[model samples]
Target: METLGEGDGPIDIHDYRHGLKLLKETRETSLWTNKKGYACPACGKPFEQLFTSEKQHNTFSPSSVTPFCIRREADRVLMFRH
Candidate 1:
């Protein structure tokens, strides 16, 4: 794995690898969202929320859900109805 950031970025190689390992080994049921994004446990790769849908909220299993964070660009912040 490669280091994701140089100075003070959210991701690093270690965290990214750890996150990938955790994703494969663990079955997380709840989805966690944050504004600053999350660093992968093994390798430091930033994971962000790319998309969300309220209609599919209860339809999918928790194990299949991938927790992500939101990164605000400029002054625009995107929000979804839950």
Candidate 2:
């Protein structure tokens, strides 16, 4: 959402939500690449959990798939993938 690039820092909730919405609408397998990292807009927490490779991304079923660098949490705002 923030024009995917390095040195862009973390994305905000509006961007993250927009990305997820696009992903769902397009039924995309993954959100860009894990080449860079992202942060949770609401909490400002970096998304440390990432898929090491594209194969790993493909292995996940659609229902269980989430953003490449995002981590699922108990907070409702952080659960954008759902």
Candidate 3:
């Protein structure tokens, strides 16, 4: 199966978190160290931290939601919602 951030497909939460862990291991912060107008999918509240959730939410109701973090430093993109 194609892994998250590998193929031209959407990302999974578990895979997203795992990627974060790997990034953390190499550095103290993320490579996409900037926000590119990221916001909440449900409420539209702007935020920076692209986090994962295992609880009830609007975007992925029920449970187990794997969101993305699309940010922009100068001219890039990141992701997240919660």
Candidate 4:
């Protein structure tokens, strides 16, 4: 994935969005994560969506919950990274 930071170059919000779009497109069908509607090849099970918050606290803004998906198995809860 393209790292957006000062060392590489000036990163714009549009650039970030474009990168995300590309990533999503490239791995839309691949079973990279266990999201809802995603069939896991390792284990035959479906996933349930979940939400967690990322710390983005600033002087003018607060953090918000980011929706994600996970599959709870007997041994672990497979968290989706997409």
Candidate 5:
């Protein structure tokens, strides 16, 4: 994964937010952020965030869910949904 602002070409904030929204909406559980830029606990790779879906394969029923932010662990992404 590449940083949103550091790439060959510039990307619009809309696109970035759109991707995040898609991940959040499609994801089964929730999205996780590896802000610390450390290896994932499960995969062991440097990531800014991780998406954990409660449903397998990021499948979900209704697609109206919204994403929320996690506190204290700004470096890591946490499950915002139940």
Candidate 6:
């Protein structure tokens, strides 16, 4: 058997409707960080995702998490992962 991710998706640190699990309810600000880092498909270098919020204090790991990419546009949203 293959080893699945710890969360729903490899990159699913937060839910658009239900919100985030790794972040605190009282803590304000959207930020994503991975110490191990993820390889960028375009640059081939490690990168992290940081959501802009009122403040800047948040972090998470991608070690066993799923790998996904979300892109939102004026018309629609796009998601892709291996």
User: Could you give candidate 5's per-residue lDDT for residues 38-64 as a string of tens digits?
Assistant: 333333334454454333233334652
lDDT, candidate 2, 33-66, per-residue tens: 2223444443444443322222323345776565
Q: What is the lDDT of candidate 3?
A: 0.36
Best candidate according to lDDT: 5
Model 6 lDDT per residue over 1-82, tens place: 1111223333333323232222323344344443344443333444444333333232335752456554333333322232
Ranking by TM-score: 5, 6, 3, 1, 2, 4
Instruction: For candidate 3, report its TM-score.
Output: 0.25
TM-score of 1: 0.24
Residue 73, model 3: lDDT of: 31
Best by TM-score: 5
Candidate 3 local Cα displacement, residue 81, angstroms = 7.7
**Which ten residues in a row are the worst by lDDT in model 4?**
22-31
User: Candidate 1 deviates by what RMSD?
Assistant: 11.4
lDDT of residue 1 for candidate 3: 22
* lDDT for each residue of candidate 3 in 1-82, tens digit (9 for 90 to 100): 2223443444343444432332222222232211344334433554434533222322434442445444333322334533
Show model 3 residue runs off by greater than 4 Å. Answer: 1-34, 53-82
Candidate 2 clashing pairs, residues 3+ apart or interchain: none
Q: Report the C-alpha lDDT of model 1 over 1-82, residue by residue, as the tens digit.
A: 3322434444322443433322111131223233344443324565442222223222545654665333322332222112
Better of 5 and 6 by lDDT: 5
Select the stronger candidate by lDDT from 1 and 5.
5
lDDT of 2: 0.34
